[model samples]
Target chain A: MIGRLNHVAIAVPDLGAAAERYRSAFGATVTGPDALPEHGVTVMFIELPNTKIELLAPLGADSPIAAFLARNPAGGMHHVCYEVDDILAARDRLLATGARVLGTGEPKTGAHGRPVLFLHPKDFDGTLIELEEVA
Target chain B: MIGRLNHVAIAVPDLGAAAERYRSAFGATVTGPDALPEHGVTVMFIELPNTKIELLAPLGADSPIAAFLARNPAGGMHHVCYEVDDILAARDRLLATGARVLGTGEPKTGAHGRPVLFLHPKDFDGTLIELEEVA
Candidate 1:
């Protein structure tokens, strides 16, 4: 079952500009522009009291967010991650509900280097969802 | 300055179906169908451990989310609300940075009955952001 609301990911056209914008305008604690080449994106976190806003920029041609950026050139909210216990069990539950999971339906190393899986956007009311195993 | 992430608002086409999908698929604590006719939308909350996921649907023809829904028929992330210490000050800071605020540059009562202002998505890396004044 879902537990905490992990982070909201936004794909941005410019990572540094986006990070700087938050830091200067919102006075948020901006951290990282960590590039995850394997994930094909560079990320920065705007740390908040209760949650985080993740800024993502495509790292390569095959980057998962590349297509999204192509669709929304200015970038946009990509997905929302939710913390879940027992990743396998959660996948099973989602499958039982006839919802489709992305990729091989297997958890992969996410930006946090934790097991994570993405659910099909169509099944989730047109919102992409990522479930990360927390415990 | 920004504090907590008040909530992530997702505009859905069907409030009931979206709430039910989350409750049944994600095992989330879903609440409401609270119609804010004044705001021209109905809402529901998926209570999470640290924050909330707000599900919204258009209430009438003049609904703010109607255009958003028209573009994204199924649903999509509408805007993210961040808590601010003093919204007027926050607006001034954002304006000083040349960031544009939506509406008449005035804070209005938000769905939570708090003074809030929306920032232009173009000025925010293509993401609509709401700043709510929180004590």
Candidate 2:
């Protein structure tokens, strides 16, 4: 059901600063620091060899990332994302195994125009996991 | 200073059950699932492309993973790990950038024959991050 690790999401207070830190420390370059209006967060992705490190900062109070940051004031790790070959098949399997899907609707295009879906933290044992099918 | 993603650490209450669930859902095989006496927990790894999903369950009260599980009972997501080429250098640079290193000691071999080091959640803003230099 899962392919590679698409990306690892980190919630930051400032995206530009985090991206600069990553670049200076690891020689990683930001791929896309695009603003996800629907998700209400601005995401900056630093491309690594096998996986990308995502820097997420909440745009406002209504954004999920902001809510997460509020809950974790120190702003530690955020979420784990897995690359799935078939989003629908993976979702169905997760559901069959009693995992709760965050969205009852279809998977949508995410930060990089990839088809993405989320499994609620409740079903996955408090982890907000994302399943993305990279095009 | 990194290799491929060694594994993702997820804090769970029941290692056995979660492992079973993963096998059932993704046809994945657990690699280690071994207990790290020093870390005070048992870890089960589900291998996938470019990364491994780690299921971390506490063996006793003193385990860090157990503490994490306690804080987040619903058991959502845990931490993100990056494959680093040199654990020592990575640690040094991160410290230089005002990032806190969890251990002031040398990198040690983990569940597998991999050298692993952890960055403090304080430095990364509430995220417990790990760096592994895989052999």
Leading candidate by TM-score: 1
> Which residue runs of candidate 2 sit more than 4 Å off their true CA positions?
none
How many residue pairs of model 2 clash at the backbone?
20
Across B12-98, the per-residue lDDT of candidate 1 in tens digits comes to: 988888888898898988999899999999999999999999999999779999999999998999999999989999999999999
What TM-score do all the candidates reach, one by one? 0.99, 0.88
Interface RMSD values for all candidates? 0.7, 2.3
Clashes of each: 0, 20
Q: Supply the TM-score for candidate 1.
A: 0.99
Weakest ten-residue segment in model 1 chain B by summed lDDT: B15-24
TM-score of chain A of 2: 0.86
Q: Model 1, B56: alpha-carbon shift in Å? A: 0.4
Go through the candidates in order and give the C-alpha RMSD of each one to the true structure. Answer: 0.7, 2.3
DockQ for each numbered candidate: 0.89, 0.60
Residue B102 in candidate 2, Cα distance off native in Å? 1.8
